[model samples]
Target: MNAKYVKRKSYLNFLQRHKDKPIIKVVSGVRRSGKSTLFLLFKQELIDSGVPENHIISVNFENMAFDELRDPQKLYRYLKKMTTEESMYYIFLDEIQHVQEFERVVDSLFLENNVDLYITGSNAYFLSGEIATLLSGRYVELAMLPLSFQEYVNWHKQNDRYKTDEAFFNDYLKSSFPYALFTDNDQELLEYLQGLYSTVVLNDIITRLSVQDVQVLEKVLATLFSTIGSLVNTNKLTNTLKSAGAAISNKTVEKYIAGILDSLIMYRAERYDIHGRQLLNSQEKYYVVDIGLRQLILRDHREDFGHIVENIVYLELLRRYQKVYVGKTKKYEVDFVAINDQQEITYYQVALTALDEQVLTRELRSLQSIDDQYPKYLLTLDQLNKTANYDGIKKMNVIDWLLQA
Candidate 1:
């Protein structure tokens, strides 16, 4: 099937905002998350705006057409030859981290004044290590993800209306990988998710780290997927796995968890002690990158709707804010602590269904306990058109909140 022209406006807007800037535009995300498609859309936008075709250069390292340019020196020489001193050259390098010494190549390219560079990579560590020092302050990183709920609704517009609760339940069960939009059968979707997960594990994590005992690593991932919104640590996970017949050490478990986090398969939210103004190391929460990946990995994780709701809220917060953490007050816990570049804070509590008074009270107690002037929110599945404020906190339906933007 041909790739759909799903215009992810948020990411495309980012590129447009940074257009023609001298700094490198680094697009990093999980595989099959529409990174390549975003590049295609942006390239077309440039051409539609009357930019000359010959002035633009784009290449995917995985393609055989660029096989000879896999070396840093050769890639550098090729780009240098294509670049000119007059008009600007727009360069898009897909999966550029595959090349040897890619950091040196990008650093080398940043020197030319007439070229604007954009590159994509699957590994988060590629942008985290010495490359940060090499290209510090010379680039802006735009982290992309699988489809958001808004995009999910957009894709379903050609067929069923995915806005209703029944339709959203099905959407929630999906991995939201852009490619999954082309598949309808349950077995086919599951197989696609399985293959995608394997590719990420085998190539991105296992091969990249040279990890042996792949079975144990998968078991670790299974444990993580099953408990999306719970507090987890290496020691507790090792004990849990030991009782389940997987005899892995805490140290090994720690390494595996680190690898998963670095692979961008899942994200960790540290506990921030609100009143004490400190970070606690003991019980950090983990959110998988996509809910569909969680459902596919766990096979029958539908019953844990509460954590699934939390996972969605966590990812939405990430997409809207620059940083997110688990907030802890003296007596209660907040589901999410979102912060922007200006250090402004927003506290949120997410619950699946909050019609019951006890559940509603519990969800709001944490946001109420925090004595701050910053914005507070209570996000639940209860669908009431709400413009009301409760004890200085905003109460809104999670679905409405997600689709608002």
Candidate 2:
């Protein structure tokens, strides 16, 4: 079955903003994260915006027809044949990493004043080393992530108008990926996600890094997935792996973690120095790229609402383009410290249900400890009639905040 593609509003806005810039547009994310679909969407938008069909050229390296362009020289020659000096050209290259010495092709293309280039890659190594050196100041990266919770909700609302808590929960479990929204079958989606995960682990991580300890790397990833939202240290990860009979060193653990981060499978949120008002250097929290991937890795126990709250918080920060961190005060800890170019905001806590008096008190105490006045919020799953505002903090339901935001 062919999958229906939904237009991503955020990516479209990014393209419109940079349409006239000379900088190369680079869209990067994990495999099957809808990068290719976004490229096609942008291409359509360009055509609609009056870019002639002859002026826009797109090549997917994964396509069998372009398999011969694996050589840089051959790829450059093919592109040269399609482009002309009379008119400006828009070049969209998908999975450009498959080409050997891709930086040469990019550099050659960039030298031409008539071409505007856009490229997509599944891994960060695609932009590393020679490419970074060659196109140092000529590119703008547009990071693509898995479907945000808001996008996820928008996707399901298309088929069903009546949204009950149970229905939304079922949709959340099923259509976590943008691609999954096209299908209703759960088992088939799980199988596809499993295959996609294997490709990322094998082709993206292992092949790119060329590591001998595959088992150790897998163990590290599994550990990270299992311990999402917890503050993690390299030494502690090394100790845990050693205790599990993995025999991996702290340095190896650190390198493996970096590899995962480079692949965009996991993001590490650093600790913030609240007193000094700066980002701290040590002990950070890691969130998986998608909750579905976490569920795929850890199959049996998937109802970790605390981790889900963490995931939502991480996505919210990304959406707002906030510099987020785990915040600590003298008395208590804040869940997030979101700072942008202009303002600084502190977030307090998250819980699945704050029905209990003890849970409510515990969640509020974290926000109350902070001396400064910023927007403090307690995100909970409970849909209470009244919103309690203590001192300067506001307590609201997570679903309401997500929908409203």
Candidate 3:
């Protein structure tokens, strides 16, 4: 069944701004995060803008029809034949990692003056190693993610599925992936998500990394998903796994974690010392790309609402900033430290509720310790005291903050 298209405004705006520029456009994200859908939308935009439909050439390497193009040399020759010097060609290569040594093809096509290249990959290694070195400053990456809270709400409203309670958005009753909106029942949504998760694990991670023990890798992933928004130590994780009868070493645990990260299914936030102005390498916190996926792993502990909400906040910050870190002051810890492309920093503290004087005071301490003139915000779920100002820190509702344009 074909799913209805929801306009991804933020990503569309980014593509619009970078259109026809002298650099390659790379879209990197987790599997089923809508990279292909974004390309379809942008291609239609190009056609509507009178760029000529014949000038656009797109191929999803995952399709069986393009199986032979998995050869880098053949793929390069095919693209060269499709593109001409007389007109501008927008070439989109989806799931580019399916082709072996794809960097050679990308680098070759990049030299064409009349060709504008845009590629999408579900794995981080698509930009690592040779490709990264080959196309260093010649590419601008748009890191795509699943739908934001605002997009989710807007989709529901536009599709006549609107609800006034707003609890569904916070509780995540439906998966946040774009295709989730097409599902009519929870059972169907669960099945779709399960299949998507399996493909990413089996195809993206295990196949790519040549994982010998699938059970061990899954156990490590489960541990990471259950402990979201908390600092993780490899030694302690190894000990915990050993207690559960998994014969794994600390190094193995680290390897599995790195593999999961490279798959783009999860992210790690290192500790940033706010006072010392340096990054601390130990006990970094991890966040899953989608809360719905984390729910599949940690099914029995759904009531752990605090960290779940914090995970949501972390993903939102990632969408906004170039770098998002767990901030550590002299004695306190800020929830997040977001730095944008222009080097502007913002401090945020997230809490389920801060109505109690002691609770509000504790959340405030972290932001107050940062001796900077930058903006500070306290995001909470409290309905009554959603908006307030304590000293210089501005407290606002997380839902409101997420819905911001």
The numbered model that scores best in lDDT is: 3
Model 1 misplaced stretches (Cα beyond 4 Å): 1-3, 158-166, 384-388
* Poorest lDDT segment (10 consecutive residues) of candidate 2: 1-10
Off by over 4 Å in 2: 1-3, 160-162, 346-348
lDDT of 3 by residue, 1-405 (tens): 112687899899988888889988999999989999999999988988899888999999999999999999999989888886678999999999899998888888888988989999998988997779988998999999898888888777776775754575654535678888777787787788899899999988898788898998999999999999888999999999999989998888887888899898999999999989889988999988888788877778787788988999998998889999999999999989999999999999999999999998899998998888999999998889788998889999888899898
lDDT of 2: 0.80
- Pairing residues by index, what is the TM-score of model 1? 0.95
Model 2 residue 124 lDDT score:
82
The lDDT of each candidate is 0.86, 0.80, 0.88
TM-score of 2: 0.92
By lDDT rank, best first, the candidates go: 3, 1, 2
Best by TM-score: 3
The residue-by-residue lDDT of candidate 1 on 136-213, one tens digit each, is: 999999999888887777667745544674476466557678877778777898899889899999878898778888
Better of 1 and 2 by TM-score: 1
Task: State in Å the error of residue 401, model 1.
Answer: 0.8
The ten-residue window of minimal lDDT in model 3 covers 165-174
TM-score of 3: 0.97
